[model samples]
Structures are given as structure tokens and as C-alpha cells.
Target: MPKANSALSRRAFLTSSAAGLAAFSSIIAFRANAQAAAGELLMVPAAPNPHGAIERLFLLHGDPLAGPIRKIVTESGNPVPAPTMESGARRVLRLMHFNDMHNHITDMHDKRGDTHRMSQIVRRMQETRAAAAENEVVLLLGGGDDHTGSVFDELLGWEPEEFVADAGYRVNSAAGVDVAVLGNHEFDRGAEMLRLGIEKDARFPLLSANVHSSAHIARDRDYTSAAVAEVKGMRIGFIGLTTQVDTRIGQPDDPDMGVASPVEAVRNVLPALSQVCDVVVILSHCGYGTGQSRSGKAGADRMIGEGDFDIAAAAGPLTDKPVVLIGGHSHTRLNAEGLNPDNVIDGVLMTQAEANGKYLGEITMSLAADQGRTGWFTHVGLHPIKSRDDRVAADDPKFDTFEKEDDYDAAFEEAHVAPLRLALQSKLAEAIGTVTAGDAVSTATVEAERYVGENALLNFMNDALVKRSAGFANGTVDLALFNATAILSGVAQGPLSFGDWYDVMPYADQVHIATMTGAQIHDMLQSNAKRIVRPEEADALDFSGFISRGFLHFSDGLRYRLVLGDAVADARAEDITLHGQPLDSMSERQFRVAFNSYVRLGGFSEAWNGKAIGAGVPGQIQGMDLRGLEYEESGLVYRNEIIAQIRQDGGISADAATLDGRLTVA
Candidate 1:
């Protein structure tokens, strides 16, 4: 592995391969065109939705001609020439990038093993560049959230000062990251630790133009707002910005550091960067969206209502210096379709490699005189890290079953990250308890049933929450709620390991108990129902609803019959009861509720609803104060408590003979 900040040249990491170049050539068969108009080609498999289209060009070993390559299918595919660089044009730069890695040091589930495969992809691209004999400046970049997702990240909470140094920064350094932006999760441990740990030890410049410390803790530590890199005679200026949503979501409030508006930050830094660098790039954690509002609009105005900064809309008008925005935070998968007029401004290309290292965002740029500007994008691709042949079949026994699987890249793991994985596995593999026969459930089953109504896994989880919260509140807690997306995967039958528990509940959300009127709770259910996609509306095997919105699952004691219909909000939640007693309306009485901090903070509620709560909203629940009831922090992390509760109950198993019937959708 390369040492941190070692001056490893791009050529050393990227070796030419004839097979890779041949693969690229096979995928693109161009026809002669008399008109000089630039042609672009988008070749993707036949998928029902546009978002499902494969927009990135991938190279696989053994079978260089593998993948769904076909003639331009009008409904499913289109081939237009890439913006033409003159016949003698040279490739100025090639950026291999990804963001929102979320501390997935080891490959599990969909992710390819380690960062080694990502490096392999980069090497292949470099090989293609070398085969063409192009003067390519290859650089690797990260958008942020390089920390805090898997068991590895959770274990690192024990070592605050070495957090980033031991985890993401180390892996990224090995992957040869040329530049990176600070993600909001960087401060998950707090500003002081981030400054002392990650910002200090990073081999490459960690840029964030908008981040500043009022107390000078960060400023004094030398966290720069902007950085400049010279690659192959081209000067590129990089500015970073973290999403302001950090103020409300994770970690305790840091009175010292403040994140400015991304647009203003870019504008503030542009003049200085433009004076010295020929090309400017924004490494932003502020995601690509119209804003907080669900409305789809174009340009900077769309950023107004959304709390998090919109990179394309905010940074496009700030400069014309051939800028590119690499973004993260929302974990969106963006490609050619993302570059359409509605998403990005003219002359600005934005990209994000969906989370968990599943994909890489590749962009090729050329030094072109466009209206007196010296830089413009020539090509962009969002390549999935896995090869077309590497797909796991839906019917495979391990498809949704949670069991010990082989490491993604054993060679890479043994050489680079083995020790850490060993430590995590040893600690997480402790036998918490055993699930009896027929009681064990898989994530697939949980997700399948979660959308339409109740599921064994979620029911078990919510029941655990209710039990734990009630213990903390001295039996005052009425019911508990959790989002379906919070459950990442399911557990297999037999002796359950703490590692398995980590897979089931990985996030670091804290438990909060709040008071809401029965009416408000009903309204919350109504709001949740509006987001659920019915069985008829989605593909039979699709699991999108599990993540998007499946009505919140409540404790076993709270039961309701939900009637499904055309108007979701109008769907009746009949016989709503808690502890076998009819619940009162909001106008009648207030009830104690236990939920993760995310819900207490009004995560899913719309702005107009009075039940909506967040950073700036009024009437937001604070420290559990409702009708003079005191709020208390349980101090127990949600995942840890779930594990403890399972142990206390001896073991958890799916009840084959009975469905709890907590929720019934007709």
C-alpha cells in the first residue's frame, strides 16, 4: 500500500492494457457524419424506467465484449456523438471519482469488496488512455461521507483522534485520491476531533470553502477552504462545501464551526481560484436536487426552498470557468440523464457515484477554446464497479439471506485492510443468542411484507424499541416507530452474531421519547401512507418502497387496520389502539411516544404540517418537553440496544404460526 501523501504519479498507478482498450472500442462503433455536430451515444439495457438505464461504459476481464451492447434502441437507447474535440485534440484530464462511501471498508451485499476494485477500474481507464497515446491527466476524487456506516466505522468511535486516519483516509490514500471534500459525516464525532484527526492527516487536500470555525478550532488546525492542483500542465482549482443539514441531523451542536451557503461560498472563492487555475471544480457534499421541495425545477431558484444547497443550480451561475461539480450527501445515482437541462445549468456537468462504493463517476475533459474559455467536458460516465457478469441472481439462496459470505477481494483484504476486518469480525461475531427453528426471518421477507403491511423482522424490531423505551421511561412510553429503510438487511436462522445485528441495524441514531397528540400520530400515519407504493403500482420483485416510504412500523402493542385506496391520505386507519385501549384524538389528549431521533426531529414530515419538526421549525419537540413532561436521553445507541434486547429475550425467531397483525392493509 502507498504511504499517505506519497507523490505517486498517475502513470505508476495506471498501466496500459490492450484488452481494456479493445473493450472500449467494441462498445462504440461510430458511423461517418458529414455534419460536424457533436454526437452522443447512450447504450443501456432495456429497462422499464429511465433511471434504471446503464449510463456508464464498463470494461470486464475474460469477456471483453460482455454486457448489454446493442444498436441504438429508440425507446431504451440513444447514440449521439460525444462533444467533438478537433481531430487532433488531446485528452487533458480523466477524473475517476466516487462519493458517500460511508465507511464500507469491506464489501458486503451489493458493494464490490474493497477500494481495490475501484482502483482496478481506474487502472483500466488509464490503460485505455495510454493505448490511445493521449496526454491524459488522471486524477481520483471523493465527494465525502467517507466515514460512518458499517461495523468498522462504529468500532472506530472508540478511537476519536485516529478515526479518519485509521479508516477512510487510509483507504482513500491507498486508492490515490488526488482531492476530496469534507462531508457532513466528517463532523459526526465533532469539529474538534475532525480537525485533529482527518483534516490533519489527509494526504491530499481536503477542501471545504464554506466551512469555518467561529472559535478558530478548525481555522487554526489549517483546514483550507480551497486548494489548487496542477495535473499535466492544466491548473485545476478545487473548492469544497459540506451540506448545512449537518446542523440539524447528526452529532451534537458545535458552537464553533459554521457552514455557509454553498452558492455564496463558491462565489466567494471563484475569483481567487480563477486568477490562478485554468479549470475550477467544486467538491460538494450539498447533493444534486431541486431543493427540499419535491417540485422539479431548473436553475439556482430551485435551491431556495430546499434546506441543503443544490450544487448545479447554485454553482452554475457563479462562474463560467469550465467548472464541474462532484457531489454527494443524497446518495443519488447520476449519469448522462443527470446532465440534462432540467438538472444542471449549461456548461456545468455534475456527477455522483451512488453510495457504498457500488459505482464510479468518470469524466473526461479537454482544453478547448469555448467562447474564450479554456476548459469543457468531453465525456462523462457513471460506471458500476461490478461487472455485468458479477450479478447475483434473484433466486440465489443467498440473495436476501444474511449469512457469512466470501470476502469480495480476498487478496486486497489480506494485504491492506485485513487486521481491521479481523478485529470487527471477532468482536461482532459474538453469539448474542440463538433463534429457534422456523422463527428466523430474512431481510427479503421483511421488506416484501413491510410495504403492504406488517413483517416479522420489523415487528420484532419495533417491539424491541417499545420494550427498551418503556424501561427507560419507567413504563410511560406508549408506542415506538421506525422507518423501514432503517432496517438495512435481515438475519438468517440459527445462532445470531452481533455482526448479523450490525447488518440489520447499522446506523447510529439515538433514541428519543416525545409526546404527540393521538390526532398528530394519526396525521403522521396519514402522511406516511401517502408515500407508500401499492403492490399493483410497483414491480412484483421491486424493493424501492421499503426505502422510499412504507408506513412507519409501530410496537406490537399498537395495532391498526389500514384500508388501502386510490387516495392514500384518505385511507382509513381504523380501530387504532394502544395496549388494547382505544386511543384519543389530538384534540382530546396527548400520548407519550418513543422513536429514533430522526422522527423526533421531523425527518419525513412536510413543512406545512403542524406535526413537522426540524432545526428551524417552531413547536419542535425539545428534550421531550410536552405538557410539562420532562425529556430524557436514553444514552443508549439504537443498534446496541437492539442487540442487548435480543440477548435479554434469549433469542428472536419469526413466528411461523402467527402474524402480529399490527398493521392490516386491504
Candidate 2:
């Protein structure tokens, strides 16, 4: 991996006079002079005096490329515009924001091959900033989820002492990320691991206003709730806010550390940030929607209707400081119009680049001062990080496929990222065991099939959990259950590599067992009926919403027939049996159930909403509370358990292990 010293050296060289005149333009660089004081603003001094009197003006045209060119108005010393505020006034602040990278270091899925390579993306931004005008300041920001997606992230996370942090942060730091907001996934491995592993080595500020820690870990952790940067004489305050979902999805690093509500967090932090800065930007990982209606050409109004807490709705009323919100988590692509059909919001602008480093969102904000008040407006565009297709028309005889070559920096990749990429490929390409499926499968196939009913991949995962629980839960675990969406992708019917399996189950969730009564089990299954679509209600079904919530997938030993009724609330799960015997319905009858932490803790709101198994239910099951259950940690992550099962069974046979009639939907 590239070192931080090399990054600093590169930046110093770019700003040096020997690099050329263009290098001197807009030298707003992040300099690590010394360890920044907690909450201290990293201020870059403004450029030296210009040749003559310059008037700075901000133009809010719809075009991103259209900005106020240099305009010099010379009069015989009629008090030239004050150098402090008006000298570089014409320059616009250009921000490159990306979120939910999920450790996608390579452009593997880009068939067109024009997407941004992680290394190339950073180099391109640096080059752009190097050539920018003195007044033009470029800031790169990450919205979060910098850990736990790819095999490299997993491997590097396992070896934090040598790697310093996850590969994503190491690469991003080398790529020159100014600041990042903490996402829910950053806490996937627990807060302490993140603090000691990733946060300890981060080159930039990782802020989260809502995430609080009272333990000793907080003493060494330099993370602050907010940060300010002085870009071209203007102080821009950044208030970071993470989703409150960490309480449901993952364990906090410290026993005392906890996340506060995003709404309240924002409201509390805005006043302090606004007092110190001309403009305030909210760096959030809370997401624009509630994991539903992620994609569509829907306008802001309709999109807002689909979401639980959108950018405009969350931070709009908090303050009037020309706020710009960069969001993540739902991976929704938002534009400048702000989610409203009319694409207009008062005193605010919202934007988010899609996940996986596929696109880089650039927002050029034109700032103007009117009667002692500063006004900020923006022109936003999400640009694809394309690959270089150098094939010429003469080279490709079949169909004239000549196209404009994309801007791909080869030297940057070789120097900063290629070594790490090669290492990851070498380590993760090793074959673990042969994994087969009854039919061809991919992320799309498994996702599409699992929506309506049971599928082979989900069944395979449930079986692994069942087998894993027996060893740890005192051999009392009766059945294993999981959400269909937990199986992210499917393996091909061949020798499965570790990378392939990691892709299928990338999260860090662990297996857990809880005891629930037969009545509670029935209520849990009935609650799943909310996601089912009856024949008559097909027209009203929101497919995206249902899929986002996902359905329950249980082991073969636990069988039940789901009988759909005219209304979803009336649906019945009949003939429920455990190991071929009718389940006892006595109030005292109990069955030990095995499941991942996500389900055991009621993280799947759609399945546990009205059920008596988890929290917020009227008649909660005794000893079935999310955290109160005498839960035993299986000590193995979900993927490792699956790998262990596959290895112990010699090789998984696809045809023999087909989905049984365990969960029949009619």
C-alpha cells in the first residue's frame, strides 16, 4: 500500500514552482503540519498578492463548467476591493463527494471499462486541483462505509497491526481524502476494532456528531463531532452525522459508546457550526430513503415520499446557512434539484454519488456576498469514472467502435494502488472448496428468486447456521433462520474460491441462538406475511419496498406452509412442524432457534414489526429480547461457518441439497 509520507511528498511536489505555472493555480491542499487539535480548523492561507486589482463574482448558471472567469476592474486606486474578502471572490469551491465505497478497489463490473479505478480517481482529482485557478478550491469528501465489502477489506481488517487500517482507508488516504463521515458499517466489527484498527491510522478526520464514547477508547480517538476548513478565505463548517441504525445492525465498539438520533444530533450541532463558518455542510450516512425505492426517475417529491428521512427534510429546517447535504447508505443517486419534482429547495442543496466508486459527484458552489450576508448556490453533476478504451477504428475492423478515450491515469495506479491490488488478488484467489448450485446463479438471480419464495442459496446459508449453532448452543438449537437478503450473491456450480464466498456473505454478522415459544414463533411467521403479495393485492404491492425489507428463510428441519389470504394481515402459516413433528402450542412449550444477530436483534423491521419475538411488540416473548436472551456467540462469522460446513461435508452437492418443501408459499 502507498504510505502517507509519499502522499505528502506528492502534494508538496505538485505545489512546488518547478512543477510548472499550472501547479500554482488554486493550491488549496490538505497539509498535515502537525497533529490537528481536536475540532481545530485546518486553515490554508490564501494565495499571495495578484498583479492587479481583481473583482471576484459568483455566477449560478445551470452549467457546472460555467463559472465566473477572471474579471479585473482597474481604476486609479479608488480603493481597490478589500483583498481579504474580494481579492479571490470570483473563485468557486469545487467539491468531489463519494459514499458507500464498500471496498470496491477495482472496476470489476464495469463492462464498458470506463469507470474510475480507485487509484486513478484520486490522482485525477489532484491533477484537477493542481490546474485550478488560485480562487478555485477543490475538496474531496467520503460519506462513509469505507470497510467490509470486498475480500481485500476482509483480509486487511483481519490483520490491522500490519495494514494499519482497512484497505479502503489506506487507499483513500493515499488518494487524498480530506474528511469522511462514519457510516453504520464502520461499526460492523465493533467500535473498538474500528477505533484501534481503522480510526487509529486514518490520515484525515473521521467525524460523527451523534456517535458518543465515554470509555478510555475515546481518549486516544481523535475523531470529533464537527470540523471546519478555511478554503480561499471562507470558513466552511462540516457537521458529520451517522445513522442511528447502528443500535440495530451492529455492536458498538465500547460498552458506553452509543449513537444518538440523527435529527436531534443535527439540531444540536448546527448552532455551534453556524457560529464559526460562513457555510455549513452536513456529511451524513443516514440515507435518503428507508432502503426502498432506491432507483427510479422519480422526482424529489416522490422520492421523499418513499423515504423515511431525506436530506432536505432532515437538515433543512435546522439552519439557514446555505447548507449542502451529502448523503449515503441507501446508495440512491440524488441530483441538485433536491428530491422534489420541481428540483428546488429553499436554502439547501442535496447530492449523493452512487456506491462502489462508480461515479464521482462534483458540486460547484458559487458564493456571493450581498449586504454583509454570504449567499451560496450550487450546480451539481454526477460524472462516471470511465475507463480508457484506446482501440482505434483501424484496430477494430468489426463495426466502427472508435470512441473518445477516457481520462485514465496509469502512472498513478502503478505508483499508489497497483501493488495493493496485486497482493489482494494473490491472497484471495486461492480455492477453498467446490461450491455447486442446482442452477446458474448470480446476485441478480438469487435476489429475484428469493423475493417470491425459498431459493437454494438461502437454504444453504440456513443449513450452515443450523449446523453451526448445535456446537455452540449446547446442542439445543432446534432450527436456524435468516433473511433472504442476507445471502448477497450466489456461487457458480464449480470450484468456489474464497473471494466468491466472501462476495456472497460479506457482512460481519455472527450466529446466535435464542429460545422462543411456539406462540411467539407463529406470530413471527405471521408478521412475515406483511411482505407477501396476494393475487388481488398485486397491483398495490410495492416490489422494491418488499424486497428491501426481505423475507425470512429458515432451515429444512423447520417446515411450514404459508397460506395467503385475501388480505396480508389474514395470511396463515399452517402445518408448522419441527423435525417432522407438529410443534407444541402450549404457552410454556419452547424451541431453541438459531439465527444471525440481524434477525435475533429484530434488525429486520419488516419481519419483527408486529411480532412478539423482538422489541416494540405488545406481548413480547420471555427470554426472547434482542439483547437479554442468554445468547451464546458462535465465535465465527457467517461466512466462516459456511466455509467450515462446506469443508466438513467434503463438498456441497447442489442436486442433493436442493430447496426442500420447507417454506411453501401458496
Q: Using lDDT as the measure, which candidate wins?
A: 2
* TM-score of candidate 1 on Cα atoms, chains taken together: 0.69
- For candidate 2, write residues 1-666 as lDDT tens digits: 111223234344334313322232233333333222322222222221121111121110011111211221112211112222332133356788888888886643223443346755765686767776554567888889887777656645532454534667777776777778888787776665676655544666677766765352352144666665555455566767777653343342245666666666565556545554456777888766543333432111111121225545656665555677787766767773434443334456667887877678887776553311255556787866654344434556642332232355566567656666677765566677775654635555675566567777777777876776656636757778777656666777777777777888887777676777777777667666544444563444333332434367788887888887665545678888877777655436877877676766555333343233221111332222244445655555767777877777654576535777888888
Alpha-carbon shift of residue 470 in model 2 (angstroms)? 5.0
Q: Candidate 1, which ten residues in sequence have the lowest lDDT sum?
A: 57-66
Q: What local lDDT score does residue 92 receive in model 2, on the 0 to 100 scale?
A: 58
Tens digits of per-residue lDDT for model 1 on 415-526?
A: 5566666656666668897776243367667656655667777777777777776567445577777776667777777788877778777765677666667776666665
Give the Cα lDDT of each candidate.
0.55, 0.58
The C-alpha stretches of model 2 lying farther than 4 A from their native spots are 1-88, 107-116, 156-164, 214-220, 246-255, 289-320, 336-344, 370-374, 387-406, 440-444, 469-476, 533-546, 585-587, 604-628
